[model samples]
Target: MKISTETRMGRNRRNPREERSSFLILCEGPTEKGYFTGMRSRRGPQLDVDIPKGDHISAVREAVSRVSAEYDAVWCVLDTELDKMLTASMLRAAQGSSVELGLSTPSFEFWLILHHAKYTKPFQSADDAKKMLKKISPFWSEGNTRFSDFADKVDSAYARAQQISPDGKNPMLNPSTSVWRLVASIQGRPEAIGRSTGAGRS
Candidate 1:
């Protein structure tokens, strides 16, 4: 039997109890928020992505405080380079809670960069990732329109991400990101997803 694209893509396959399941994504930056929002528009009506007004840790704390039954999943999309101490605190704060962390090492731009190519080199800073991205696309700083252009390539990016970390551990080790796992979850492939806790600085 041939499977439909929706079935192969894992869309609209939630269980009866999870029929009303929805997601709440707390983004650390506007770009992250816009990225998730673009995916939401293409995916369906089960997501609400927001960019809280604060630093990464504070925003994570804010997300933790707002977790309720209304949301079946709460995710915080953060860059691991924000601050070592703050990232540590954010991980601790999310422990035992429903808040899942989707971390990109060096920066979230690394995840975006993955859409264009497979990158394994470590970045010293988020700026480094941005610089490399600019080399691939001259108008890299254009904004959400740029992100939407590559949103459909998320699965390719996710596949490339898997090649970097086979054990699914320590994603903060420079050129790595757990963002693909979160993207998988958002795409309705929950089995391909993994939480971003215990991913420490390397």
Candidate 2:
């Protein structure tokens, strides 16, 4: 049997600039926003991240309202400490829409903690998670958290999250997080890492 040229070259290859996946990330707060912004800065041209003003429940609402074909994906990065009923309603609204929610138990700080340590202890609140993070990562402070702090440790964090929650389907699991799902999605793309070309998630 003769092999076809398309098969040998791989039929999936395309122009990164033209087919680049664009994402609209609506974060719950400054910390979440800053981390994703840093991700945008580090991702290759194959990915584009657009973060607009909106947070927490507002972010979920914005994501629901802004569901359009303009962007490939709409993500809402939020914490679970907000009003349970309100968050549930917004989450219901997101159903059947393009909006994908990345929820961290208590707060996004829990996800950060995974970067420094493998912790499965449940947090009482965002403040509690922040306190724990401070103990291990003194660099993280209110309004001062940067992506560079955890840039090199992204893989470690992802692995830790997986260990905590392998399925990664629940947003309400205490001491569990879904942020790794979003990060893994981005890292899976070809040439997704901005710092290096052709970097693949390991």
Candidate 3:
């Protein structure tokens, strides 16, 4: 995909000759691909969201290898429960590479649940998170969930995620996710952390 060199609206507004940061988002599943593909930024970095064929590790490795000078950041969106061994291997491989991880523990549904309310309880598996998520969003279907349903609540979710995990580390921890950190980066609002609504319930 070609990178957009045109300046965006807010902080990214600069002379036409100025360069914009390009981003590559590699997702683990169709749901992640669909969600991130809808993300738009008027002033933030340009993004290319993709879901490559193969396991998460191999996909991530492929994505990392594709990160050339044309892209400034390459983010891999993964679910911790999909493949623990592969996830670990991918993390190890990302050590020296430019690839960054946006991981969700148990499943990516945990991140989506945060959009509605705070849920700190540890989920047994991705299915567990999905079951709980259906309670809040009856329309949610794995790999079919739409981004438009919760796009407006992204900030709320991000704040709740920070409240639950301030440092944004350790995806092995139940109910922990660093997806918000990536969203904040895409939005160019690193300082937008810690603003919570306190509406989340256990």
Let me know the TM-score candidate 3 reaches against the reference structure: 0.81
- Tens-place lDDT per residue, model 3, 41-89, is 6655677988888886787778778879877667888887845675577
List pairs with backbone clashes in candidate 3. 118-200
Question: Per-residue lDDT for 1-202 in model 1, tens only?
Answer: 8889977668756665455457888987767876777775533547888888878778778888989988877888888784567667768777767687877787888888888899988788888888897897676663544457786787888888767865446746778888776776667676645543432321
Over 4 Å off, model 1: 1-20, 42-45, 145-147, 193-202
- Best-matching candidate per lDDT: 3
RMSD of each: 7.7, 8.1, 8.5
TM-score on alpha carbons, each prediction: 0.80, 0.77, 0.81
Q: What is the clash count of model 1?
A: 0
> Which stretches of model 2 miss by more than 4 angstroms?
1-16, 41-55, 82-86, 189-202
Error of 3 at 54 (Å): 0.8
Computed on alpha carbons, the lDDT of every model, listed in order, comes to 0.73, 0.70, 0.76
